[model samples]
Target: MGSRFVNLLARSCNGGPRHFSLHRMNPANLFHPTRSAVPAVQPLADAPLPPPALSFGWPGKKGELAWMNFMAFGRTGNNFLAVDQIGRTFFYDTDSRSLRTGMPMMCKPIMDPISIAVGDSLYVMSGNPGPSPGKHCFQALIHGRLPASDTNDWSWYSLQPPPPFVNDIPRFHEDEVKSSCGDVPAPYEIGAYTVVGESQIWVSTAGAGTYSYDTVSGAWSKVGNWSLPFRGRAEYIPEHNLWFGFTPNNLQLCTSDLTASSEVRPPVLQNMWTDVVRPKNWTLRDASLVPLGSGKVCIARFFVTHSDNFEDMSAYKKRENFAVLEGVEVLKAGWAHLRMVKHKSERYVFGRDLVIPL
Candidate 1:
């Protein structure tokens, strides 16, 4: 096993839990099921109410605060996917919300990703990609599959998609192929996915450009050569029989069959929410893909920061008088002023190691 897989081995497998198997775990805790999708869990009354299975719980670490953005990882069990820090994808079992067994598929490091999916005997699409500082450089639109039962029997391939164009239509509804979302201040990471069914491939990219590699042909095309809007990332809701975006602030999106439309596909969004995790002063970085159960997703995001003036005018005034008497006299005293509140009681932030969900 690779180091990444090995390190998470005990927690993800062996000593911990295997893929979320309906036949294995508590059946009463499932979320729900999508069309042609699997059920993630059976509704359990005593368990913590999974906030609608609509919240996409995005996880991150800032200083000492481990920020978690959540959405209902809906029960239909086919849309959710996770791309670890490294470029690894783990398909989650819908009924169990656990990763599929024996799959640590060899893929590139997706810097940040949000969603993924597979169809037509191929990994049609894998994640939501974009141009945030937190997103990945997204060099290769690679594709391949391992022996269903053999990890060692894996195959890999690379791709070369086209460059990006401008979308200047303005506004989410009137969005052109070149409008820039204020959300992506700078290219951070690209980690999210959307489905372009008409093309028979799932396109992953925002602003950076569209990419759909034919698993069978091993060819990469910038078919939908428009912008991957920052307002939303790709998501397939099996239950709704539709595709959506996992943007922050509860915003849901609809995708065009990039394959069917002759012109650039128009992206539709639901004002239900928007990306709440806005950066202070960040840019596009990178992204990656992760497979939870029903399908997989790419988390494309960038590192963000905030700043404020902290100079003490009072101290400076005193220093002016001292300096007037002698150049050696100096004055400087200040400290950060900000209020922080934590919701979780656990002092330790990395609860996965200690909590052991599976």
Candidate 2:
């Protein structure tokens, strides 16, 4: 995310010391095909595991834990903002390893809401409200800005809803024609979103194309009839001048020049790498890419195991719930080539608890 580089030492999976390139490159040639090569997956090194910096479970009641959905957004540095299904908010600081309560949201419970943090403000958008048969279920936009001081109160305010996807609209009988705009259903869940520059949030939805929301003016405008090439949140790195994120279908690590995307052309994948080789029985639940500054990154992936053969409910209950953390560094070779060096891999079990990186 930042352009500055730090001198960090890490060992590659092959047990050799790997140095991350600190040389800065021209932003204009960042996406040129001749400037880079396909990255190879190097094995991870076996190293001493570090002590856990923080550990906590669902912040909601035990009864609500089973059904409650949790989402987290990195506010700044080590500070993270978390929200549960019941609109409760929690703030966690990784640097201090402290967790504190925050002002609750004003909106109703939204399942698996999409969230992003830009500057001092955090935003939450479309999500499934609930299971209402024959009725639409989607939430509108709400955002909260960080208080300037400890004595100031924190709060969430409503914003204009995003434009709806044409295909996501529910079909109605001819006799049940609606009369007003309120009759139309809410928009579908967003496919992906990322902060552009320092003030604009770019959101992409299937069939609805792409749109940009200006944080300063609180205005939304159509960008193009195309969706973002990546899924979920894409991290923009100034060092390489590229946005890195997971591919939509397979979740492979990929990079693209998001700013180069236009009304007629979608963002093209400049480079891609298979960071993890998952097994057939291991189903991926969620994945996140965390930037550790410089050229270092941590890939966190949550998975659940399943049986190949038919099993009883009791046998299925015994399936393992675990997560894998992979450390990697993007290095510049010579003047044009780029390489991804695998550093370490660690796995942890969390039983039935859902784990996500902030």
Candidate 3:
């Protein structure tokens, strides 16, 4: 059976080695059909919690000089890439928690970029060449698998510039430059990207509009206005054919249709939000919502809080909580059916970069 992994980056509070861990989960075991039929806030620590399959050092440091700034990340099958502050990208085998040999990306790294894996390929958009000469609004596709041994290598090839709708947005002045290929428009800073079915990738920029790229024909089109509270961070729940967005205080839903509406139906960008049950005395840092095998959803949240509210931010401690919600229709989620199933204490000062297999 296929498994899903949650990847997180963190470090010890006492200034120890930074650690990256991948928690493995088999969605089939995440829920029970015969549990309480009504909605109620239950303690997650009472249920069985899945453990980490792989944990290791965070890439980027060689000596005593590493600063550990998270740059970007993407996953292709069991392999995941972690980009460091200096623009170096390292690949790891999630099954073994081992690093694979490979050269870093050809361009300099910036901030949040649209990164995703489709089949055997990893596609990265924007966040390259670090906006010096110009904002590099380009896309690159890394093909092939990890080298058979330490001596072989994979290939990174740049794709054509994103379509007009992407480059045409007024976020930045369009720069026309020639790469090794030919004349192309610079890449725009992409806030998030997600796969839409089998043939398209949906992108939300740092501001305003949302766009989609056709994988088969290599074309781009404006999909909808990005007015939702959360942009790229929203996760798709296939069972309901809807997108789920999260905040510390609420959970929101919207149609997964990637098209702007004209006359027939309302636009999917308009979202309906609902309050969720959170543990007392916990402040959320990051969270992820992934589909559990049979019409169930697992919501994983990273939280932090201080022994005393008057203390400095550095005094806060971190923990993770997991909850399961089942059988509630998305449109009619007036009262949540969520329950806490697991909890883990994190020794790190903090955590970020919640990556789950798509």
**By lDDT, who's the top model here?**
2
Candidate 3 Cα lDDT to native: 0.47
lDDT of 3 by residue, 58-131 (tens): 55554744433332234324456666656666666665767764655636553445565554566666532323
Clashing pairs in 3: 44-340, 44-341, 136-187, 137-186, 137-187, 137-188, 138-187
Clashes of each: 133, 0, 7
lDDT of each: 0.29, 0.58, 0.47
Q: Which ranking of candidates, highest TM-score first?
A: 2, 3, 1
The deviation in Å at residue 236 for candidate 3 is 4.0
The lowest-lDDT stretch of 10 consecutive residues in candidate 3 is 341-350
Query: Model 3: residues >4 Å from true position, as ranges?
Result: 25-29, 33-41, 46-52, 55-78, 85-88, 95-98, 103-106, 127-137, 144-153, 162-192, 225-230, 247-256, 259-266, 269-275, 306-308, 311-358
Off by more than 4 A, model 2: 1-77, 102-104, 128-151, 161-187, 312-315, 333-337
Q: Write the per-residue lDDT of candidate 1 for residues 1-358, one digit (tens) a residue.
A: 0001000111212234322211112221221233224323222122221222222222333343222211112223232334444444444444454554344533455432333223412231213223322222223222344547443332323233321221211123323233233343223223344555433344434444455555455465555545444344444434233343444333322232223344366443422222223334432222212222232222222221223433865533222100000000011123311111111110111112211111
Q: After superposition, how far is residue 77 of candidate 2 from its true place, in Å?
A: 5.2
Number of the predicted model whose TM-score against the real structure is largest: 2
Over 1-358, each residue of candidate 2 has an lDDT whose tens digit, in order, gives 4322111111112223321111111122122133234235444332333334433343445355423333443443345555555676666554465777755564555455666777656676654221131121323223434557545455666664433344444554545533323333333446678888988888776546788888888787778888898878998876677888899887888888888988998888877888566578888876777666677676766687888766577657667666666666787665534677765565655444344444
